[model samples]
Target chain A: MAQNDSNTKDMILSLNSIEVLYDSVLLAIKGVSVEVPRGGMVALLGSNGAGKSTTLKAISGLLKAERGKVSRGEIKFDGKLIGDILPQDRVALGICHVIEGRRVFDHLTPDENLEAAAPISMSRAKIKSEKERMYEYFPRLAERKSAQSGYLSGGEQQMLAIGRALMTQPRLLMLDEPSLGLAPFLVAEIFGIIQRINKEQGLSVLLVEQNAVAALEIVSHGYLIENGRVVMHDTAGALKENSDIQEFYLGGGEGKNFHEIKHYSRRKRWLS
Target chain B: MDWIFLSELTVNGALTGLLYSLVAIGLVLIYKSSAVPNLAQGALTMTGAYVVLAFSHNLGWPLWVAIPLAAVIMFLLGMGIERVALRRLAGRPIVMILMMTMGIDIFLRGTTLAIWGGSSRSVNLGVSYDPFFLGDMLLSRIHIVGAAVAIALFVGFLLFFRTRLGIRLRAISDDYLASWSIGISVERGVGLSWGLASVVAVATGVIWGEVQGVDQSLSVLLLKGLTVAVLGGLDSIVGAIVAGIILGILESVGADFLDPFVGGGSRDLIVAAVLILTVMIRPHGLFGRHDIERV
Candidate 1:
C-alpha cells in the first residue's frame, strides 16, 4: 500500500488492489499490486502457497472458474479493463500464460501440440515458418516431432510448453513456476531462453518463480510476494543486494536453490 | 454350425459389425470430448430417420438430396443441444452433465413421438436395384454401400485427429486449463465434437431406417449402439468400432443359436449382460488410457 505513492510509468499491465479468495475461508491472495511495462521481465517471487500462483491465475482469468472471485481490484491490460475478459479472449489479445507442470496434450504428438497453440489466423506458410523458428529455438523438440508429448522427458516437456507459448506470438508471456522440479543445469537453460525471448523478440514477461534468486538475476524488476501481498519491490539488482532478501528469499546456496533456503514462520499464512 | 455355415455367418456378422461401429464411433467422440454419455444420441439417430422420411416421402425429394439434408439437420440439432443444455453446465461435475443429457433424451423422445404420431412406419428410397446373390446368400446394395461409407468415415477421423484442429479438441479433453491458456476455445471445440457425433448418429439412423424400417421405437433401437460403444471402449474411437462389430455378430449368432433355449427377447438381455461384463473388466473400456496422473 505504501509503494502506491511512488508512481511509475512504462506500465504494460497494471493490477490495482487485486484481491482473490477461494470462498471466504481461503484468502489465497490479498490486495496485491504490480506493474509490468512492455518488453521487460518482472519476477513475482515467493515460496509455495505464497499466493504467487493465485496472482497469476487472477491475471489469466482462471480464478473465476474456481470460485476465487476478485472481491476488489482493477486489472488493466494494455490500458483496457481486461478483468471481465474470457481466457481465450486474453490470448487473442496476446497474453500467453505458460503454466507449470508442463501440461501439454499427452495423447497428441509434439508437432500436433505445437500446431494447436498456433493462432487460428496463421496461414500454412506462416505455420511452417513458425515451426522452423520453434525448431531453431529448441533443437531437441525438433528431434522428436512425431513422438507423443506423454513420452517426452521432463526437460523436453518444459521446452515444448515454452515453445508452444511462443507459437501464439504473444505480447506478454506470463510464466508460472518455470524452475520447479528441474536440475540446476536445466533451470539455467530455461532462464537463458527467457532472457533471449525478451531481448531478441522484445516479448514482455511476468515470470512467477519459487526460484527467486535465479528469477531476480534475469529480470529487470522483482516483487517479493508473501501471504498474498507484495512485501518488497525494487530493481532486481537492489533486491539481489538486500541482505534480508538474500538470506530468506534467495537462499545462501547458489542462486538457483531457493527451495532449500525457505523459511515459513513470518506470515500468518492461513489468515492472509 | 458347419464350417461353410460358420464362415458365412462370420462374414455376415462382420459386415453388420462395421455398421455398428459407425453408429458407436460418434457416441465415443461426444463422450470423450464432452464427458457426457448423451443418451440423446439415440434420439438424434431417430430424428435423422424422421428427417429422411419427411424429405423423401412427404416432399418426394430424391434420396440423394434427402440423406445429406437429414444429416445437416441433425448436426444443427446437436449444436442446439450444446447451446441450450451443455453450455450452461460447463466446468460442473461430470454426473450433473450426464443427468442433463438424460433430460434431453426424455424431451427429444416425447417431442418426436408426439409429432410423428406413436406409430411404426417404413421408408424405402425408390432405388430399383435387385438384391445380389452369392452362393445361396442374399446381400443388398444398400448394406454394401452403408458398410463402405462407415469404414471411410472411420479412416477420415483417424486422419483428422492428426490435423491441427483435431489436436486442439484432444488437448481440451486432456486438460481444459492448459488448452485454454494456449488459446484453444474449449466451448467451440466441445460444440464441434458434438456436431460431429450427431453427423455419425444421423448416418447410422439413415442406414438403419433403410435396413429395418423406421418406427417410434427407433430411439430404443439405439440401445444396441450404446452397447457397442460401452463394450468396445468408452473413450476410444477405434474401440467403439471394433466393439460394435463384435457385438453385432455375437448378438446375431446368439439369436440364431441360443434364442430358442433362452426364450424370446433374449438378444436384448445378452447385449446388456455383455456390456456390463466389458465395463466391469476394464472400467476405462478396452484400449483406453489405463492410468490418469494428477498433480
Candidate 2:
C-alpha cells in the first residue's frame, strides 16, 4: 500500500516489506520489498539460505505447505492484494513458480510432465499448442520428450522445469535456482531461452539465482539479498559493477585467509 | 479331482479376485495422491453397505437409486474426512497420518455399530443368485458382475491417468510443494482421492454386501484389500489388479485343496504369506517404484 494505485498498476508483482516466519518461530525473510513490472525480468541474487527462495514462496502462497507464513506486509499481484490467496488460485491469477532444483515428475515422461503442468481447465488443443511452443523454445526437451524425465540430464531437467512452468501460461514466472548444477554452456542456453520467452510473450520473470553474473546478464534489474534482507537493489549494470558484488559474488576475491576477512568485512558493510 | 470342478475353481477364483482388486483400487487411489494408507477403507466399506441397505430396505428405494445415492454421500463424506480429519495433519510425519486413519477407522466402526446394532443385515441388489453353467464350469453371476465392474474401473482409470487432471493428481503424489507451485491444488488432489476411495468403498460394500451378509466381519475385507495393495505395490493400479487375481486364486485353491488337509480356514494365512514373501523379495511390491531410484 506504500505505492499509489497508478504506481503499482503496471507491476505484475509487488511485495511490500513482507516478513516470513517458519513454523511460527524462525524469521526467514525480514521486511523484504521486491517488485517485477509487467513483462519485465528481474533477479533476486544471493547465496544459500539468503531468503531468495522464501520470498518467491511468499508471493506464490506456497509458504503454507512448509508451515511458513507471511506474518507481515501485503503482496499485490496484478493490482490485487493477493497475500491471502491460496497457491493454486495464485497460479490461476497467472503466478507460476518453478521451485528450486529440477523438481520434474521423474516417473513421468517429459511430455507427460508438461501436460500435467498445464492448467487443469485448459483445453486439449491449447495444451497441444502450448506444448509445441515449449518444444520450440527448448528444442532439446522435444528431442528427449518421450523418455523418462528422471533419466534426463540435469540441464534438460532444468529446461523441462521451466517448460512445465510456462505450461501454466503464467503472467509472472518465478524460478528458484534454475542454473544450479548445470554446465556453463547449458545454463547460458536455458537462461537465454527464458529471456526469449519473457521478451516474446511478455511473461514477467522473477528469477532467484546464486549465479549472479549470468542472472545479471539476462535480467534488467537485480536485487542482492544477503542473510534475509535486500542489501542492494539496482539496475543489472550497476549490480555487475558494484565492488562488493564483484569481490564477493563474481569471484574477484583471492586467498583463503583473505576471503574470510573480506566475507566478514562485506557482511559488516552490507548490514551497516 | 474332477477336471471340471478344478477349472471352475480356477476361473471362479480369478473372478472372485476381481472383488479384491475392486477394494484394493480405493486404497491405491488414496495412497497414490496423498501418501496416506487409509486404514479406514474397510470401515468405510462396511458403513457404505449399511448406508445402501438403509436406503434400499428402510426407505424402500430401488437398487439403482440407492447405489448411486450412497456413492455420492460417501464421496462427500470422504472429502469431509479429508478436510476435518486428514488436512490438519498435512505436514506431519507419515506415522501420524497413518494413526489418524486408524482413529477414523475406530470412529466409523463405533458410529456404524451404534446406528445398526450388532446384528448382520442382508443387502439384495436383486442380481439373480442363480448359478449358470459356462460349458462344464458353474459360475455365480455375482462374480461375473464383479469382474465387469472391476474391468470398467480399470479402463476408466487407464483413460483417466492419460488425461491432464490425472497427471496432475499423480504429480501431487510425486511432490506436494512442486505440485502446488505449478498451481496444482494438492488439497483438491488429495480430497478427490479420498472421495474416489470412498466411492469405490461404496461399490465394494454394495457388491460384497450382496454376496456375504453385511456384518461386522465385513471390516475384515480391509486385510484382503491391504494384502493385494501391498503385494501389487501400494501405489500401482495395475499391480493391485494383478496381485488381487493372484491372491484370489491362491485363496480359493487353498481353501479347496489345502484347507482339507490343514483342518479349516487358511485363506487369511495365505494372504499373510504372500504379503511377507512379496515384502522380502521386492520391498516396493510387484509394480511399485517402476524405476529403481537411479543411484
Best by lDDT: 2
Residue-level lDDT tens digits of model 2 in B1-295: 7988888998899999989998899899898878788899999999899899889999999989999999999999999999998887886788999999999999999998989888988888778988978998999998889878987887888677777778888888887878888888788789999999999989999888878889877887898899899998998899889988899899888788878888978877888899889889887798886652653
List RMSD in Å for every model shown: 4.3, 2.6
Kindly report which residue stretches of model 2 are placed more than 4 angstroms away from their true locations once superposed. Answer: A1-9, A254-272
How high is each candidate's TM-score?
A: 0.89, 0.94
Tens-place lDDT per residue, model 1, A129-239, is 998898888899999989878888888888899989988889999998877788989989888988997999899999998888788889999888877877777889988
- Top of the candidates by TM-score: 2
**With candidate 2 superimposed using the best TM-score fit, by how many Å does residue B291's alpha carbon deviate from the native?**
6.1
A46 in model 1: Cα distance from truth in Å? Answer: 1.8
Model 1: lDDT of residue A256: 43
Model 2 residue B258 CA deviation (Å) reads 2.5
Q: Is the docking of candidate 1 incorrect, acceptable, medium or high quality?
A: medium
Tell me the tens digit of each residue's lDDT in model 1 across B1-295. Answer: 4765665666677678777777778777886675567777777778788888889888999888988898888788888888878886777888898888778878888887888877767667553357756676655667676778778888888788767788788888877778888888888888888888888877888777777778767777567777888886667778877786788678777776877887777778778888888777877776665444534
